[model samples]
Target: MVTKTIEVVNAQGIHMRPAGMLVAEMKKFPNCNVTLKCGEKTAKATAVMQIMASGIKCGSKVEITAEGENEQAALDKAAELFETGFGE
Candidate 1:
């Protein structure tokens, strides 16, 4: 298992558009389960609704985890998205 932390730099945070994108990306890594946590709230990265429901605003602290064969790649990619601020 590997974990990464990134700040939500997007002005709107992980809204529907980005949430959908993130979930879509996560779905590609079937061997790993991606988990996202914002502050005290955590949600499965595969669930778009749950991620959106987390209400992670701009500058929120996000932690992501990937566990499995490609955990490292998964975590790195997920962190990249966060660094992009979900493309906001």
Candidate 2:
């Protein structure tokens, strides 16, 4: 598994649009399993509802984990998105 932690930078946090975008991007890596962890909450990265429900706010630190084939790539992509504030 590949793992990385990033602080959300988007002003609005992981709302509908960003959650949808994250799910869309994660769906591309069929061979990998991606998950997000924030405090005591955890959610599947491919589930938009779960992501938004996690209440990950701006400046919140989230740990991303990707396992299986293409794990590294998947983690990298997630990190890029988080670092870029989901292109807000």
Among the numbered candidates, top TM-score falls to: 2
Per-residue lDDT of model 1, residues 1-88, tens digit only: 8998889888887889889989999989988999998888999999989999999998888889899879998899899988977666
List model 2 lDDT by residue over 1-82, tens digit each: 8899999999988999999999999999998999999999999999989999999999999999999999999999999999
After the best TM-score superposition of candidate 2, give how far the Cα of residue 50 lies from its true spot, in angstroms.
0.4
Model 2's lDDT to the true fold?
Answer: 0.94
Question: Deviation in angstroms for 32 in model 1?
Answer: 0.2
* Candidate models: Cα lDDT each: 0.89, 0.94
User: Residue 23 error for model 2, in Å?
Assistant: 0.5
TM-score of each: 0.95, 0.97
**Candidate 1 minimal-lDDT segment of 10 residues:** 79-88
lDDT at position 77, candidate 1 = 87
